[model samples]
Target: MDAPAERLQAADAELQEIDERIAEIGRQNLDAVADAYKEFSAVLDRYEDRATDRDDFQGYIEFREQMAEVLGSIPDDLPHRDAFTEADDELTTGVTSVLKHANFDRARSQLEPAREYAELRSREQDVQGTYRDARSALQKEQSTLETERNELERLKRLGEADLDAPVSLLREPIEAYNDAVAEAFDSFTHAASARAVLDLVAETTAYPLVEYRPPPENLHEYVHESAVGEESLSRLLDLAGYSSSKLDHYVENPQAFRSNVATNQSYLSGLSATPLQVSWPPVASDALGWHMRERIAVVGRFATDEVVALARAVRDLGLRDDYERLRTSATARESLSETDRTRLRAGEIERDLTTHRASLDSVREILATYPPLGRR
Candidate 1:
C-alpha cells in the first residue's frame, strides 16, 4: 500500500508539470497572435488609406479630363484651360507622393505581420492578400489617369481648329504676293528679250500695264535703259516699235536690271542655277507676291517658257566657261613630259615643271643604273 501511494503522487506531479508547460506555450502563442493581429490591422488601415487616396486621385484626373475637353472646345477659354492644366499637374503630384508613402507604410506593416504569422506558423495567405490589394489599387489609378490624359490631348488638338479660318484668310493674299514676287525675280535673270523683261516686271507688279499709273519708277529706268541703248531719249518713239537702238541697248547691258532680278543671280547667270544658300524668303509673300500693298496692285507677268529658255542659255554659257578652263588646265598639264609626270608622282616637282627637270633626270638615271632587284 505505501509503494502504491508513492507511485500515484509521482504520477500526479508529472501531470502537473506537463500541464504548466502546455499553459506557458499557449500564452506565448496567444501573445504572438495578438502582435500579429496588431500588425495586420495596421497594414489593413494603410491599404485602406491608399485605396482612398487612389480613388481621390482618379477623381481629380477625371475632373481634369472634363475641364480639358470643355476648355479645348472653347478657344476663348485659355485662362480656364491653363488653370485646369496646372491643377491637374498638382493633383497628379500629390496623388503620386501619397501613393508611394502608403505603399511603403502598408508593405512595412504587412511584413511585420507576415513575420509574426510565420513564427506562429499560420495565415501567410492573408498577408499576401493585403500586398495584392495595395498593388491593384495603384495600377487601377495609374491606368485611369493614362486613359484620361490621352483623351485630353485629343481635345487639345481639336481646339486649334478655331484659329484656322481667320489665319487662313490673313495668309492668302500674303501667299499670293510672295509667289508673284518670287516668280518675277526668278524670271528676270533669264529674260532673253525686252518683252520678256517687261512681262516679268508686269507680273512682279501684279500685271500692271506697262504705262500704268503708279508704275515702278525705278523699274521704268531700267527698262528704258535696256530699250534705248546710247541713242537720244526719244519720247517720239511709238510704243510698238523696236528700233536698232533698242537691240543695241539689250546687247550692252544684260545685267542692267540686276537689282530687279533675284539676289542670287549675282553669283550665277542662270535662273535654274543652284543658289549658294537654299534658303526661303522670310515671308511667303516675298516669295509669291511682288508688292505687299493693295494700293500698288498691278504687277508683272513673264512667259514661263521664255524664262526657262533664258535659264538654259545661262547654264550653257556657264558650262562653256567651265569647259574652257578645264581645257586650259589640261593643256598646261600635258605640256609636261613623262619624266615630269614621274617627278610629279614622286613629289619631286616642287617648283614648276621647268625648274624640276634635274630631279626627274636623277630618278631616271637611278632606274637605269640599277635594274629592278628581282631582275638583277
Candidate 2:
C-alpha cells in the first residue's frame, strides 16, 4: 500500500476501535441504570407490603370492637346477652394491656376509675352509682383507642407517601439521554464519519461530558481522572501525551500518543463506576445536587486543542485531516443556528466542565460506606 493509503487504512482502523470502545462503555452504563431501577423497585415493594399489613390488622380490630358494643346495647332478656357479657370487658382488657406496656402511667390512671366502679358493685352500695361510674370509664377508654388508632393511620400514610416520585424523575431524563445517543451512534462509522459527529458535538457550546479514563497512577497503574483539577495538565506532562509516565518519543511522531487497548478499558471501568467524576450538570449546589447525582454515564468532552491532538495522530500519518482542528468554515458555521454560534464563542461547555467541584465533593460523603456500585 502507498503511504497515503496506509495512513487512511490506519485511520479507518483506529477510528473504528475508538468508536467501539466508547459505545461499549455506554452499554455498561445503561446496564448499571437498569440494575439501579430494579434495586429501587425492590425497596419500595417491601415498604408497601409492610404498610398494607398494618392497615388490614387495624381494620379487623376496629370491626370486632364495634360488634361487641352493638351486642351490649341489647336488654338482658335477649338470647345474646350472655355472650355479650362474656366479651364485654375483653376488648377493654386488651387495650389496657397494650397501654400498660406502651405507656404505663396513663394505663394506671385509667384503671383507677374503672376499679372504683367494680368495688362499688361488690359492696352493693347503690347499684345506680356503679352503673354511672362504669359508663364514664367506658367513655375514657374509647377516647384512648381513637387517639392510638389515628396515630397509627397517620404513620401508615406517611410511609406510603410519594417516595417513588423522585426516583422516577431522576431516571426518566437519563433514559431519554441514552436513547438519543443510541440513535446518533447508528451513523458513526469511520474516522471521517466520526469527525462529522465530533463537529456536531463541538458546535454545542454547552454539553455534558463524563470525564472517563482517569489517568494511571504511574504508567503501570491508573491514577486520577485526566479532566480533574491539574490532572489534564499532568497528562500533557506524561512525555508522550497519553498520560503514560514514560518518556516522550512522540512530539514529532503521532503514533506514540495512542496507548494499548487494555489500559484504556481498565481506566474507563473505574471512572464510569462513579458519576461524580464526570463533567456535567455544571455546578453542584442544592438546586442542582439531586438531579446531578442521577447521571449514569456521560461521554468525555474534548476542547479544540485536544481534538486536534487526536486528529494529529492521523493527519501526520500523511494527508492533512482538516476535520481534527474543528471546522469553522462558513459551511460548518451555517450548519448551526445563531444561538449555538453565540454559545460556542462564550465557551459555556468548557466553563461548566470546571464549575461543579463542590457538587462532586458532596457525593463523595455518601459513597464512603455504601458504594453505589456495590463491591466493585
Candidate 3:
C-alpha cells in the first residue's frame, strides 16, 4: 500500500477503538445516570444561594423537593446508583446548615462514572471526523497514480521492438535521398525565379507529412503579379536593401517592393528543400511511401536526373518484406534513452506497473468501506 492508504488504515483502527468504548459505556446504563446528574446539578444552581444559612427559608423546602424528584427518576437497574444517592444525601444534611462550595465539589466527585460516559461519546465524534479526512486524502492519491501507470505501459510497448534488426537498410537510402535533394533544391532556389520556387512549395500542401508553412497571402500575390517576381529570391532580397531612388533602377516600382518583398524578407529567405527531406527515424512504411510519391513529383520539376533517381530509390524501400520490422527497430533505437534500456533489462518497468495496480485496488477497497460521508 502507498502512504495515503497506510494513513487511512491507521485512522480506521483508532475510530473502531473509540466506537467499542462508547458501546461498552452504553451497556452499563451510565448514559441514563448522566441525565439524572444533569437534573440534580441544575437544581443546586437554582436554590443554593437562597437556601444556604436559611437566607430564604421557603427556598430550602423547594431545594429538598427537587433533589428528591431527581433521585427518584433514576432506574433501579442503572449503574452508579449509589453515587447519585450519596451526592443527594450530602446536599440535604440539615435544613438551616451552612452550605459551602466544598460540599458541591465532593458531590460531583462521587458521580465520576456518569461524567466519564459523556466524555467518551465526545471523543468518538472527534475520531470519526479524522477517519473521513484520511479517506479523502487516499482518493486524491489514486487519481495521480493512474496517469503515471499509463505512461509506463507506453514505454513497455516501445521496449518490445527488436533492437538488433538491420535498420541501416532503411536509413541508408533515406539519408542519401535527403542529402541529394537538399543540395539540388538549394541550387534551384538560388538560380530559379521566386515564382517557380513558390509554385513548387504550393504543390506540397496536399501532402500532410510534408510540413511546409504556406506562403503569406500578400507575399504570394506580390511574387506572381509583380515583374520583380522574375528575379531570383536572392537577388530580390538584395534589391530590397537599396535606398528608394537607387531601388527604382533595379525594379519597376520600388515602393511596391518595400511593402511586399522587404516587409516579408524573413519568409522568402527561410524557404528551402528542408521540408522535402525524410526524417532519420522514418515513419511507417505506408506513410513514407505516400510522402515519397509526392516528393518525387515536386522535386522532379527542376532537380537533376541524379537527384530524381535517389528519390525513386527511397520510394521503393516500402516494397521490401522487412520494411515494417526495420522501421519499428529504428524508432526504438532513436527514441529510448540509456536509463530506459537499463530499466527494461532489469525488469523494473513490469515491477512498477504491478505495484501501482495493487495500490489502486487497495485504495478502492477502503473507499467502498468508508464511503467518505463526512469528509473533512
Candidate 4:
C-alpha cells in the first residue's frame, strides 16, 4: 500500500474512536440528567406528603377540641349531677385522709389546688393530652421526612456530578459544545450583567433608575395584590436573553419566590415601622450577598473562563446606592435618642456583617472547587 493511503486509514480509525467515545458520553449525560430530575421529583413528593400530614393533624386537633368544648358545655342531667356529687365527696374524703397522714403544709399545698381546679381543668387536660399525642406523631413523621430529604439531596448531588461526567470522557467534544453554547448565550448573559451593573452604579451614584419600596404590611394581601414582582423578574430575565420558554417557566411562576420574599419581609418587618428606624441594611446586604453567592455557584457548576470573567465584573461593580443609604441610616441611628432604634440598627449591622462574611466565604468555596482557569 502507498504511504499516503496508510496514513489516511490510520487518521480515519482515530476519528472513529473519538466519535464513539463522544456518543457514549452523550448517552450517559442524558441518563444522568433524567435521573437527577427523577430524584428531585421524588423529594418534592415527599415534601408535599409531609406538609399534608401536618395540615391534617392540625385540623384534626382543632375539630377534636371544638367538639370536646361543645360536649363539656352541655348541662348535666339529675343522674349525672348526683354521680358528680358522689365523686366529689369521695375526693374530699381522700384529700382529708392525705392531709392527716402527710406533712400538713405539703399536703395542703398539693391537694387544695387539685380540689379547687379539677372541675375547671379536667376537659382542658384531656384535650391537651390528645394534642400532645398528635404533636408527637407529627414529630416522628417530620423526622422521617427530614431523613428522606437529606438522602434525596445527597442522591441529587450525586446525580449532578453524574450529569457532568460526560465532559471528562469527551473533553474535547464537550469543550466544543461549551463554545457553541457560549456563543449562543454570550450576548444575553453579558447584556444582563451589564444592565445589572448599570442599575447598581446608577443607584449608588444617586441617579437611581429604580426606587426601593417596602413590601406591604399584610403579607397575604401583598401576595394577592398582583404579579408585579413576578412580571418584573420575567422582564429582567428576558432582557438578559433567556429565550428558552422552558427555562423561563419557573421565572414566570412568581409564587416560587413568594415564600422567599415573605420570609425576608417578615425579618425586615420586625423592626419599627418608622422609615428611619426600620433599618434596611440587612436587606441591602443580603441582596448583594445572595447575588454574589449565586454567581459563585454558577462558576462552580460551569467552571469556565467566561464565568470567572463575569465574577470579576460583578466584584468590580461595588455596593448599590440603596445599600449605602441603609448604611448611612444605620450609622445615624447610633446617635438617635431612642435606645430601641439604636439597638435595632446595631442588630441589623451585626446580621448584615455576618451574612456578608458568609457570602464571601461561599465565593471562596467556589474558587476552591474551580480555581480560575489558569491558576496552579
Clashing pairs in 3: none
Q: Flag regions of model 2 displaced more than 4 Å.
A: 1-160, 163-171, 181-213, 217-265, 268-376
What is candidate 3's local distance difference test score?
0.80
Candidate 1 residue lDDT tens string, 239-340: 213344553444454344344322222212322212111122122322212222221332213325444333333223223323333323333333445764
Better of 1 and 4 by TM-score: 4
> Per-residue lDDT tens digits of candidate 3, residues 1-376?
6666666677778777866775776644645765676777788777767657456777777878888888888887777788888888787676457676677777778777766765565565676666666776877877877887887786787789888999889999989998998899888888999888887777778776777888887888889999889888788889878889899898888888899889988888888888889887887778878989888888888899999999989988988999988888888898889998899889998899898888778777878876664552
Cα TM-score per model: 0.16, 0.18, 0.57, 0.19
Worst 10 residues of 1 by lDDT: 273-282
Candidate 4 accuracy as TM-score: 0.19
Q: Comparing candidate 1 with candidate 2, which one achieves the higher lDDT?
A: 1
Tens-digit lDDT track of model 2 for 166-282: 332223333444444333233221222222333333333232433233344333222222211123322333433354333333333233234432334434223222332212222
Q: Point out the higher-scoring one by TM-score: 2 or 4.
A: 4
Candidate 1 off by > 4 Å: 1-166, 192-297, 300-376
> Model 4: runs farther than 4 Å from truth?
1-124, 127-138, 145-167, 170-175, 188-376
State how far residue 152 of model 3 sits from its true place (Å): 2.8
Q: Quote the lDDT for 349 in model 1.
A: 44
Candidate 4 lDDT, 224-284, residue by residue in tens: 4434333332243342343345434644444443443434443333322121111222234
How many clashes in each candidate? 29, 6, 0, 1
Rank all candidate structures by their lDDT, best first, as comma-separated numbers: 3, 1, 4, 2
Output the better candidate (2/4) by lDDT: 4
Worst 10 residues of 3 by lDDT: 25-34
